[model samples]
Target: MDEMTWLDYLPVLGQGAWVTVQLTVWSTLFGALLAFAAGLGKLARNAAVRGLSVAYIEIFRGTSLLVQLFWLYFALPLVGQAIGINLRLPPVTAGILALSLNIGAYGAEVVRGAVQAVTRQQYEAARALNFTPRQTLFRIALPQAIPEMMPPFDNLAIQNLKDTALVSLISLADLAMRAEQLRNYTQDSTTIYTLVLLMYFGMALVLTAFMRGLSSMVGRWRPAQR
Candidate 1:
């Protein structure tokens, strides 16, 4: 085979990059949702709700993300078969699920910490105003806590983006997988890996900028709630 040039490699890699972007976007969105749910649940007055939230956070945080991906993509189907159910998920679906769940567990701790850091005086003031628990949380606590959460959440978002590379192991055809395929065919390890690294860095920069802008917006909004 003739040696492939950068021109030929780029388009194929671009396709793979698109897939990676999609996975990152979906996983981050879902993970944020899960983080809030689990975080708030942990703070709930109800014991059962708190226990379940703690269990979910612990299970995901304590385990390896790679193992989580493998179990979701491989073991789940067999477990389903034993129960006469189809628990198999598509590679992309499985990838997103594992990534979101893992990141969510970590983000939950960030959420919990930020919320807890809100001063006791704030809660007392809310109570003085005859605010209900739900009203105080949404109106007072979250408005303060959410801004604090953004920096850590930004880190988690970037980490989630990098973690999406692991999906290539499950044949998801992400950027890493495409780069690996190209390397196997061309044996151009240095060039191929370098391009992949640069591409990931570029994506990370973009994600970071977006997250910072979001954080700024939240910071501005927090004062308005006062």
Candidate 2:
């Protein structure tokens, strides 16, 4: 058989790359929302509530994501059947669920740290001004903590995006899966994996660039002194 040119696999990579982007982007955005809630829960006044959040974070963070993907793809069907829900999660949906849960666990710690970074002085000032806890949080603390947390949050985003490749293990048509398929037919495993590596690098570089640009813009804005 003639060795096919790299052009033959571009379409496959393109399709796979799109799926990877969708998985990473939506999961990160919505997962961050979930994490914000979970993270706040980790700091809840109720000991039980905080404990639940902490346990959830530790469980997900401690496990391998590939295992989570397999469990979601395979084991959940049995549980779903027992509960009478649909006994299946499609690849993309499973990817979203697994990715969301994983990222949410990590993001919880980020949010907790960011929230705590707000100085006591700021909280005291807000209280003196008669701001409610929620108001002080939304109006005074969140904005201040955002910049401090941005670095960690940005790192997480890049990490999650790269991690999306793991979804391919569950038969997701992601970039890595496409690369593997190309390798199967062409037997040029070296080149295929190399391309996959570069593809992920390219996407991460784009994300890193965006974060750096946003940091510069926010830095230039420099909030006005009270």
Candidate 3:
């Protein structure tokens, strides 16, 4: 077989990278939303709300994301058939759902911890201003806690990006999957894997820079000064 140039494999890998990026972006967005909702739930006055949130976090955190992905893509269809319901998910949908749920579980802990770390003085001040618990949480506690949350959130975001590779196992055509295909076809495992590894590293660096900028902005956001 003739030695294929890197250029020969670039297009296919580029397409795969696009899918991976989309998965990472969408999953992170949804996951963050879930994180906030569940985090707040953990602190809710209602026992039922707190119980439900704890259950969700524990269930997802306890399971492997790969198994979650498979359950959604493969097992759900069978379960649906048994129940006479169409619960089948497209590969991309399943991938995004699994990634979002998995990361959201872990992220909820970050959210909870950061919010809880807010000083008692801040809460007392909010109360002195006649703020309800909800108002205090949203307006005062959150604003102060957000910056503290950023570093952990940034780490979780990077982890979420790497986890997108698991979707490739379900045939979602992500970067890792594309690299595997190219390696099999060209029999250049070293070259294909090295490039794939570099691509992932480049993405991580870019994400780190973006997170740093966001963290800086958050750190500078002083409501009192405004």
- TM for every model, in the order presented, reads 0.97, 0.92, 0.95
lDDT of each: 0.96, 0.86, 0.92
Q: How well does candidate 2 match the true structure in TM-score terms?
A: 0.92
lDDT of 2 by residue, 1-226 (tens): 8767777777888899888888888999877887888898997889999989999899999998888888999999999999999869998899999899998899999989989988999999999999999899889987777676667878988989988999889888899889988888889877677777888889999888887776665555566424
lDDT of 2 at 197: 86
Q: What lDDT would candidate 1 get against the real structure?
A: 0.96
Best model number under lDDT: 1
Worst 10 residues of 2 by lDDT: 217-226
Q: Which runs in model 3 stand beyond 4 Å of their true positions?
A: 1-3, 222-226
Better model by TM-score, 1 or 3?
1
Q: Model 3 over residues 1-226: C-alpha lDDT tens digits?
A: 7878998888999999989899999999999999998988998889999999999999899999998899999999999999999998989999999999999999999999999999998898899899998899888999888888898999999999999999999999999899989988998888788888999999989998999899889889655432
lDDT of 1 by residue, 11-74 (tens): 9899999999999999999999999999999999999999999999999999999999999999
User: Could you report the Cα RMSD, in angstroms, for every candidate shown?
Assistant: 2.2, 2.7, 2.6
Better of 1 and 2 by TM-score: 1
Model 2: per-residue Cα lDDT at residue 159: 87
TM-score quality measure for candidate 1: 0.97
Clash count list over all predictions: 0, 0, 0
Error of 2 at 107 (Å): 1.0
